[model samples]
Target chain A: MSDLLEARSVSRSFGGLHVTRDVNFKLTTGDRVALIGPNGAGKTTLVNLITGDIAPSEGQFFMGGDEITGLSIPDRVRRGLVRTFQTTRLFANLTVADNIALAIMQRKRITRRFFSSSTELPEVRAEWSEILSHLGLDRLAYRKVVELAYGQQRLIELAIGLALHPKVLLLDEPAAGVPHDEAPRILEAINRLPSDIAVLMIEHDMDLVFKFAKRVLVLAAGRLIFEGSPDQVTADHEVRRAYLGSYADARRPT
Target chain B: MSDIAVTHVPHKRNIPFAQEAAGALVILALGAIGWFLYPDDLAFLTRLIGIAFLVLSLDLVTGYCGVATLGHAAQFGVGAYAAGIACIRGVSDPVALLAVGLCAGTVMGLISGALITRFRGLPQLVLSIAVGQLIAGLANKLSWLTGGSDGLSGIEPGKVFGVFGFDMYSRTAFVFSLGVLVITFVVLQRFVRSPFGLMCRGIKDDDLRAKMIGVSIYPRLVVMYGVAGAVAGIGGALTAISTGVVGLDSVSFERSAEVLVMLVLGGAGHLWGALAGTVIFMIFEHIVAAANPFHWMTLVGLLLILIVVFAPRGLIEPVVLLWAKFKRKGSAV
Candidate 1:
């Protein structure tokens, strides 16, 4: 099977420090990959490179065999590759439902007519209601996004990503600021999503990285160190020594 | 179990009809009153409406869509020149002149919009001002076509629909100008409620996120700016019809700035705010100018300063606040 996303000899640097250096990575279609790394390991930068937010200093990125390294972020999204931010980006003044509806409308043919009604389309309305209902956001549909709790805002972000209808969803620390109690629900939402859309998730939580991802890739100091199952990763000696040593005892639930 | 069930059904969307009819009635009443009274200064009032329509166009782009434009007067001038040049060449039909003006305005707007939207922030404003100056320069250089600062003259009001001959009287002009204003206002209202307008709002709020969600900002702004130009072009042609002349002042920076002030003074985001601001600013200008020439500009400057400092939402918001307070007081009593 071929990888749905591929990076070849990707390296990016700022000033003297080498943030990412000659990293090669791949994710097969429908692959659930967990990227685990210590702080400042260039995990987020890798995601940015893949999504075309920043060009690699040296290397190429291909999505479904198409060179996407030079494409604009919006054009990359239209080609079915998208990335979410570490912090949520929702239109604070718009309603939760409107935020989703606006995303869906972006995919349609936009004309220059002064009086044509784009919102009156039945399909657009149905998709809006469907996304809202599927995400359990029906009750907060009309409420302003700023009024929602932090967790709810994160869900809105996920809903926004869902509306893009991307084939690959890149989540950058989605559960970072979410509460302990609500984190599982969000994780469960990701777990329950359809298997067609490949997910590349960057997380610090060992349990979350273990619970949801089928394949694990570890990064340390902007380099890919290991790739295997969670059990194989937990049992590796060097992998345990370099990063997982601190979490060794904490890996098992009390 | 003692209560009987009842059903409620909508009686045919009365709000849209009522709003439309009320707007039409107001315009008609104003026309009838102007015709009967035949105020000696009715021409001035008709000219005010024409200028107000131009300001409304500026308000839609700058206020509603968050497009920072400093050169829309170029569009107004293009329409005026197109219509004037057409008339001077014996193409005296009003409908033909209107179509010509609209086409000229649309082309100018699209070209300028494409150029300006490529650059962002202060660069956008600077580029627009440069485009404005470019048009103004062309108008000055094209001496034969534009009359070269001597000003275009010998314009006759001709006839409406080639049937009712327009006379020196302001009655026909007033009615025609009022009809155009009502139509423009209704179309703008519907536009702001549509999905395209909503996406523009989203773009204004956050361009990056809008892009992430697949909203292309540049092309959208270009289209909207073009539409706004078409509307303002009509306004310029209307001004030509009423005044029977086109002057360099139609493309002045001061004219553009004054319209911006009217928009900010009326309120942003609300279409009626633009209309209300135009009306108030025109009335204010008329009263103050009548008192003294310098007093008109100075008074507008002072009023704008006060509004910016005290009530930045414009006069409409303050009026709404006061009305709400009065209602609450009456209910308490």
Candidate 2:
């Protein structure tokens, strides 16, 4: 199967500290993977490199087998590589529906004629209704994003990424601050997403990671330490010593 | 960010159908009464309206589009010069004046917008200032045609479509300017309510996100700036035709800053905010100057600082917020 995204020997450094070193990774079609690491493991750097947020110091990255290491962030997104920030980046002043609507509107041309009457476009309006209804945000669609609860905000972020129509979605941290009950729902939503859309997420919650991700890759201090099933990841001595050391403590509600 | 929940107060009042009709009728009636009663002052009032229209254009760019411009007056000056030069060279037709002014303003705005777009932060502000200075200097250096500091005088604007008999009595001039001002206001109000305006607001809030979604910020901002410049150009042309003079003051930096203040004082995001700000500021200036010109500047400065600090949303927003607060207390939402 063709890899949806691939990064070969990608390395990045901030000054002398090697944030990411010789990090080779690939995401196959329909693959769900988790990038697990302790604090400052350079998981985000690897994601940034693959997503074209930052270029690798000495490596190649590809999307659908085309070199995209030099593409701008927007250009990369246009090629079906999109990402979400760990910190939710919502338009604070705009309503929830308007936020998603903006994403839809920008996907088309920007002529005065096209833009002048976009609000009434039949297709656009229908898509907006469908997206909002699916996310259970139809009631608060008109409310400003800042007024939404944290959980709702995260869902809105997910919806925004979905509206981009990306082939590969890179989620920085999907369950970072989600409540236990909410984490299951987020995982369920991810599992139920269309099979064509591949997801690669950086997560700290092993429970949620094991539940959703079919394949897992563990990073330790800027290097790939383990790449296997959830059971293999838990049994690996180095993975247990480094990442799962606090797994038992994290069992408590965050 | 805290929700001061109290009641469901609509953004506007829900008056009875009859009451809404009556309110519109009353306003029109009063306007008619004032129109005839103050015929002599109509010329001044009309000129004020034209100036207000220009400020409204600035409001659209700065307030709506979130573009900080310091060379807007240069665009206004380009319009005045285009119209004045056209008139002196025998194109005394109003339509010709408007066409030339609008085209000139739009061209200048697009050029300047393109030039300053690549620079952000302090560099962008500096580039805008430099653009204004360059245009003004060019006007001054091209002395023989522009008439330099003395300005283009002896501009005898012909009657509107050669029918109104635009003599020095100024009656036709006032009516013509007023008619143009009202039309411009209607057209601009529509423009703001359109999808383009909403996209401009979206860009203002977050240009990066807008671009990620596929809206290139640069091209849209340039087009908006050009439209606003074209509108402002009309106001400058009105000033020249009605008053029959164009001076260095037309392209002065102070003029640019004053229009910005007018937009800010009225309200940043509201359409009528610029209009209200222009009217209030002009009346205040006129009243203050009649008593003591120097003291009026100081008072205006102090008042602007107070407004910026106390009512950061401008005069209109504060009033709306206060009204909302009171209504919330009264309702049981």
Steric clashes per prediction: 0, 0
Residue B201 of model 2 has an lDDT of: 78
Question: Local distance difference test, per candidate?
Answer: 0.78, 0.76
Off by over 4 Å in 1: A110-116, A234-245, A252-254, B1-40, B316-333
DockQ of each: 0.32, 0.31
Q: Per-prediction TM-score of chain B?
A: 0.88, 0.86
Model 2 TM: 0.87
Best by DockQ: 1
Instruction: Return the lDDT, model 1, position B159.
Output: 82
Q: Write the per-residue lDDT of candidate 1 for residues B1-333, one digit (tens) a residue.
A: 232111111111124446556756765676567566757878877887887777777876777667787888888889888888888888887767777787888888788889987887899899888998888888887889998686677766568887866567676787778887788777776777577877777777777888787666788888878887888888888887777888888888877777878888898666767777887898888889989986678888899999989979987788766865785576446
Cα misplacement distance, residue A112 of candidate 1 (Å): 6.1
Worst 10 residues of 1 chain A by lDDT: A111-120
Give the per-residue Cα lDDT of candidate 1 at B149.
Answer: 83
- Give me the overall lDDT of model 1: 0.78
TM-score of each: 0.88, 0.87
